[model samples]
Target: MNTISSALWPWLALAGLGAFHGLNPAMGWLFVAALGLHRRSRGLVLMALVPIALGHALAVGAVLLAVIVFGTVVDATFLGRGAGIILIVWAMTHLLTGHRTPLRIGMQTGLAGLALWSFMMASAHGAGFMLIPALLSLCVTPGTGVELAASPSVPISFAALAVHTGAMMAVIGGVSLIVYDQGLAFLRRGWINLDILWSLALAGGGIFLLAG
Candidate 1:
C-alpha cells in the first residue's frame, strides 16, 4: 500500500506524456481515424484505435527497456545522434519512394498488425525520446531518488503508457466516428488528399526530429 501509493506520481506523469504524444498529428492516429471515416464504419474506426494504441505502447516500452539496459552508456548525446541519423535516413527513403497506399481498416490485419505498425512508426519517429525525459525527471527529482530507485519503474511506465494510448485512441476514434456519421461522402471524397497530407506530415516530422 504505501509502497504502491508512492509510485503513483511517476506513473501518472508517464501516462500524461503518452497522452501528449498520442495527440500529436504525426503519431498516426489521425491517419487511422481518417481511414475509419472513409470506410464509413464507426465500429471499425473505434476498433482501429486499439491496435494503434497497443503498437505505440510496444514502441515506447522497447525504448524504455533499451534505456534501462544501457543506462548511462546511452546518454542524450548518443540517442540524439543515433535517432537523428535514423530519422534522416527514413525521411530520405520516404522522399524517394513517395507514400504508400493507405491501409484499409479490417480484422485481417487486426490488433497485432496494428500494434506492429504503430510500434514501427513510433520507433521511427523517436516516440520514446519523449518518454525517457519524463521518466528521468521523476527519477532525478530531489526527494524521490530512493523511491524511484526501489520502484519497478518499467512496469509503472508501461501502465501509464497503456492508459495514455487508450485515452488518445478514444478521442481520435470518437471524432472520426462523428465525422463519418455526419458526412461519410465528404470523408470519402477527401481520402486521397488526406493521405497526401499524412505522408507530408510524417516526412516533415521525421526531418525535424533529425535536424533538431
Candidate 2:
C-alpha cells in the first residue's frame, strides 16, 4: 500500500490541480453552461468541452515539451528552483491582478472561439507552470538528455498530460451539467470568489517545487 501510494501521489497531485483549474472562475464554466442553456442543448455543452480541453492540453503540452527539451541541457534541480521562484513571482502578480476581467467571449461565440479563449486563459493563469513539479517527477528523468528519442518517459509525459486534462474535463463537464440544470441563478448566488485560493495554490506549487 505504501509503495503504491508513493508512486501514485505525483500523478494524483496533477489530477487534483487539473480539477482545481477546471473550477477556477476564470475558466468560464458559467459561460459554457449559459450557452448550453441558451441553445437548449446539453450536447452543445459536451461539445464545447472538447475544444476547451484541447486548448488546455495544447497550452500545457507546448510548455511541457519545451521544458523536456531544456531539461536535456540543465540540471533538473536548478531548473526546478528557477521554476519555483518564477511560480512564486507569478503567483504574487496573479494575486494582485488575477481578478481583473477575463477576455470577453460573446455568448454566441463558436467552439473555435471557446478554444482560443481557453488557451489564453490557461496561459494567462500559468496553469501549465503549476504542473511542472509533478510532471518533472513523472516524465523527466534526472540527469538525462533527450527524452524524446531514447526514454520511456516520453510516453509517461503524454499519459500525465492526458490524466490532467481528463480530470479537468470531468470536473468541468460535471459542473456544467449542474449549472445547466439549475441555470445561472445558482451560480450567481452560490459561487464564491476563488482568486485568493488560486493565488495561494500557485504559491504552494512554487513552494513544493522549491522543497524538492
Candidate 3:
C-alpha cells in the first residue's frame, strides 16, 4: 500500500498542474465563458467543455505517450534535453506569432472546430511538454533511465489521464459559470495578457527539464 501510494504522487502532481492550466485564460475556459455569454445559454458553455477537455487530453497524451515509449530507449538526459528544445522552440514561436497573427475562429464554430482550435492552442503552448517531468518520474526509474516499456500499466496511465482531465474540466466549469453569470467586467479593469506569461512558463519548464 505504501509503495502504491508513493508511486501515485506524480499523478497527483499532474492533476494539480492540470488545475493550474485550467486557470489560465488560454486554456479555453475563457472562450467557453464568452461563448455562453454570446449565446445567452449556459448550456453552450457546458457543451463546449467536452471538446475543450478532449483537445487538451489529446495534446497532453501525445507528449506523454512519446516519453513513455522513447524515454525508455534513450538516455534520460538526452530525452529531457530534446523535450526541452521542443518546448523552448514552441514558446518562441508562440511569443512571436500567437498574438500578432492570432487564429480567428467564429463564435458559431461547431464543436469539432472548437476542439481543433483547443488542440492547436494547447499544443502550441507545450502543455503536454509541461507534464513530461512528472510523467518521466512516474513511468521511469528516477536517475536511472531504465524503461518500464515491458511493463506498461494501462490502469496507471488511464488514472493519471483521467485525473488530469477531471481537474481541468472542473476548474473550467466552475470558472465559466462564474464568468457567465457575473461577467468578466473585473478582468477588463485589471486585465493581464496571460499569453506572455504562459509562454514564459513554457520556457521555464523547458529550462528546468534541460537542467535536470
Candidate 4:
C-alpha cells in the first residue's frame, strides 16, 4: 500500500489547497453570506455556492488543460518556473492592491454573472497557477511523441480536479451556512486581514513549486 499512498499524496495536496482557498474570506463565502442577507433567504447562499464552485473549477481547469495539452512540447521545469513567477507576481499584486481594488460584485449580479465574476476572481488570485507543480508532476512524462501522447496521468489529473473542487465546495458551503446563521457581527469582533495571509500563501506556494 506504500506505492498507492505515495501516488495519492499529490491528489490529497490538491484537495488541501482547495480547502485552504475556501477558508479565505475573499474567495466566496463572504460574498455568499452577504448575498443571502440581501435576498432575505439563507437558501440563496447555499444555491450561490453551486455557481461559485463551478466558476472556480473552470478557472483551475483552464490551467490544467494547458498543462495536459502541451506537457510534451514544453519542458516541465520551464513550465513550472513560468507558473511560479506568474503566481509570485499575482501575490505581489494582491498584497499591493487587493483591498484598494474597486472591483466589487453587486448584489444584483445574477447567478451567471456571479459565476463569471468568481472565475475572474479565482484567475486573478492565481488559484490555478498554484497547481502548476502538481500538474507538472502528474502530467509531464519522460517520453517523446506517441509515448507522451498516451499519458497515463490524464485520468489522475481529472481525479485531482474533482477532489479539489469537491473540497472547496464543502468548505465554502459550510462556512457560508455558519456565517449566515451566526451573523457577520461575531466575525468582525477581531478583524484579521486574511487577504495578506492569503497573498503570502500564494507566494509561498509559488516558491515551493520553483524549489521542486
Q: Compare the candidates by lDDT and give the number of the best one.
A: 2
Worst 10 residues of 1 by lDDT: 141-150
RMSD (Å) of each candidate, 1 decimal: 7.4, 2.5, 2.9, 3.0
Clash totals, every prediction: 0, 0, 0, 0
Q: Give the TM-score of candidate 1.
A: 0.57
Worst 10 residues of 4 by lDDT: 141-150
Evaluate all candidate structures by whole-model CA lDDT and list the values in order. 0.57, 0.81, 0.79, 0.77
lDDT of 3 by residue, 1-212 (tens): 97887688788778887897888888888899999998899899999999999988998887777776776577777888888898788889889887331667778998998888888877767788877766666666667755456266344566677888899999989989888888989577664777787788778778977887
How would you order the candidates by TM-score, starting with the best?
2, 4, 3, 1
**Winner by lDDT between candidate 4 and candidate 3:** 3
TM-score for each candidate, following the candidate numbering: 0.57, 0.90, 0.84, 0.86
Pairs of colliding residues, candidate 4: none
Q: Candidate 2 on 76-180: residue-level lDDT in tens?
A: 777788888988999999877664436778889999999988888888888888888887777655455333332665677788889999999898899998999
Candidate 1, residues 102-121: lDDT per residue as tens digits? 53434345567766767777
Residue 152, candidate 4: alpha-carbon lDDT: 68
**Poorest 10 consecutive residues of model 3 by lDDT?**
146-155
Q: Is candidate 2 or candidate 3 better by lDDT?
A: 2
Candidate 1: pairs in clash: none
Q: Return the clash pairs for model 3, or none.
A: none
TM-score of 4: 0.86
